[model samples]
Target: MKNNRYLLLVLLMAVIFFSGCERILDTEGISRITSFPTFQMQGEEIVTVVKGGTFTDPGVTTVEGYPVTSSITGSAYIVPGKTQPTDVVYTSGAVDTNVPGIYIITYSSTNPDGFSGTTTRTVFVLDQQPDPAVDLSGSYASGTSPGATITKVADGVFYSSNAWGGGSTVVIPAYLICTDGVNVNVPQQESTVRIFGHGTVAANGTLNLLMSRPTFGPPPLIDLVKDWVKAN
Candidate 1:
């Protein structure tokens, strides 16, 4: 009977030891569950904007599935393909509005628990539209002497001559700014020198130009106004 009692005591001790070990493992698993938080994005993953335009942010949110409650903060940044990104704001400005290309926007969030998450979105900045009111693809005459000739070399680009007088020829790059197609303004720049001019086109095919050259002093060194009419 004593031998049987000793055998039963050994079995009971083995069961008790295993039960304590299981309890310890269960507590450790629960501790790990409450230690980390969760995060994710909530809106559009892709968007597009025109060149020289503004961008709108969709936004993001965090999800904490565990019993713990923590506040999460996020930030968005830009990664350009070729040129450096500029004018970066909080959630927008992932793409450079002045340059046309594909860009990536990374959104990252972090909590007090040292846990973090990241998501990404793609942005495409398209080329700007051409203005119909300002057409610089023909010949023009200002006063007398030698007339100016303008030819359309490419989209939104023009090659011209007689910009600085003396019958000298130069390439003139122009950009058209139109408000409601009726009011048009053409800003032109000389490629060789730092001479710039802006002109307003009237309904009678007359272009009134105000030209200027920047100087190291307070005011510009050269400022002249001239009128040009379209030549047949």
Candidate 2:
């Protein structure tokens, strides 16, 4: 038992020595404390532009006192930073009003401390008004959600009250655009929830919708398909 105790003590000392050395080596990256700058949108995060109409960017600003690029210094706003930000790049996605699609604009800034911050905006370009004959505004009931309201803003534009099919801790509306009254799309938009999906409506007025959790890449964490029937 005396020999076993000595061996155990040696092993414990070795572990402690190695752990201390490892921590010392790992401190190289975190030797200096730094913080990433945050972004504040000047206008709405989601902008809707009418097809064939001119589109303009409302731009963004810095909230946590971050410097901005010189090009946008006059247009873009900033709070103020300890040091001017370097290597600032404002990349804006192309927006063609003649075509209907979603565009993304991104901005990135790096502070003198080598920390970087980035943000993006989403723009939707499509005709809000649809054919007068098309109307899908009604209460839809599905297995997961019951009595989800679909409010009509225009002939083709509708807002779904329950995008997650109910049971969500926070309820947010999702935009459903159906131009021809057959095909449907849930654009990537920010609300209490970020929604992205597509579905179709049958002749019998049955809605076959599929939704994915908010994600920046393919293969979302949560994928769900809900078939909603119009409540009589």
Candidate 3:
């Protein structure tokens, strides 16, 4: 009877010791990853530019950690002007210059171990004219007449509204090309008669337009000097 008790105790102790050893071995097999691949932006958080200006993409940097068995790959996407987060598309860092608003650029990177990271940057495209001296792009109001709107379509190129008080309500397309900081040459895109106009853009966003009409037999006749004040 005493031998049987001693054998039972020995078996129990062996089982306990083996269980303890197994626990320690399992713990030793597991490892805690202290570092991971991280993605970060290299430059300023906000990039500002005028409309029709080139945008330089400040790329991302990936910090590789231990166990670099795989390489890190990155992609960029743009959240279009004042759009929702779900409205994003992968891009090659090309931004639309026509749209003037806030754009969000998201960059993400992934590693072979399924570890990933992401960062974002903002780009602001302003509608304001780039040259401080030439502020010709804005809405203008002249007396009780229908207001005219002028917007910068490209660098130094502006689109202007049609003249008021015409029998036809059709809008005549007109474009102004700024040769100098103050001088502007208007070229009529479409018109039955040859139209010639010139203007000067003031510092306070005012336009002084001197238009000419076709004379039947002599030099072009000068029309009234129309002063357009920039609308608030």
Candidate 4:
């Protein structure tokens, strides 16, 4: 029984430690565990550029491994006690501001131990500016989720307080863009989670959002809808 318990404990530790690692450990021992590298975008996840406008990348910062205790710093496999920021190389989707569409830019970095992390940014090229007369800024709540606050950033661009509905414990925000006053869309972006959605605003100020979140997992939701009622 004790041997089985020990084996189970070891398995659990391995699962937790190597959860996001891209490569197998170099050695059999646990002395050299590699923490996954992460990339942080320097600017907003979503940006809009007018037709024939020039778009400049805001760039990103990459870090290898989480900070560990001083005792573990001596391990050659582990990054020292401090976080190591590295220059990351990125691959991006083409962006032509002259065309009205969306573009995606992805940034990726690999740690010394071979673990890699990736993040992405989205850009929208508009033929014309959003209509300012239509504002959907307010608190919206659904039946399954709590509530999300929508704040207007640009004329028709909005930022939600929470990405996956309102009741999610992780408060990742999603951007909603409305070219017209009625139709709304959530661009494809990563807020620690990847999300793509679209919906509309009703005459009575109700928001009906259909979110497609592969990160949330499961049978691949296609028709899932969240009817958000605007609360003053």
List, residue by residue over 105-188, the lDDT tens digit for candidate 2: 666777778888778665656655456677788988776544578887655667788766633444556777777788777655
Number of backbone-clashing residue pairs for each candidate, in the order shown: 0, 0, 0, 0
Off by over 4 Å in 2: 1-95, 98-124, 127-129, 166-170, 215-219
Tens digits of per-residue lDDT, candidate 1, 80-127, equal 221111222223344566764445565565566667666666554545
Per-candidate Cα RMSD to the true structure, in Å, reads 17.8, 14.3, 17.8, 17.8
Q: After superposition, how far is residue 97 of candidate 3 from its true place, in Å?
A: 2.5
Q: Relative to the true structure, how large is the alpha-carbon lDDT of every model? A: 0.49, 0.63, 0.55, 0.63
User: How big is the positional error of residue 141 in model 3, measured in Å on the Cα after superposition?
Assistant: 30
Q: State model 4's lDDT.
A: 0.63
The collision pairs in model 4 are none
For all predicted structures, in order, the TM-scores are: 0.36, 0.48, 0.40, 0.53
RMSD of candidate 1 to the truth, in angstroms, is: 17.8
Model 3 Cα lDDT, one tens digit per residue, 1-232: 9999999999999999999999998899478564455765667766656668888776767776323222222112222231222232223334555654445566666676676666776555544564544436788766555677887655555667854212233344455556346766553222444344566778876777665434322643444365668877
Report the poorest 10 consecutive residues by lDDT, candidate 3.
68-77
| Pick by lDDT: 3 or 4, better one | 4
Per-residue error for 73 in candidate 3, Å, reads 19
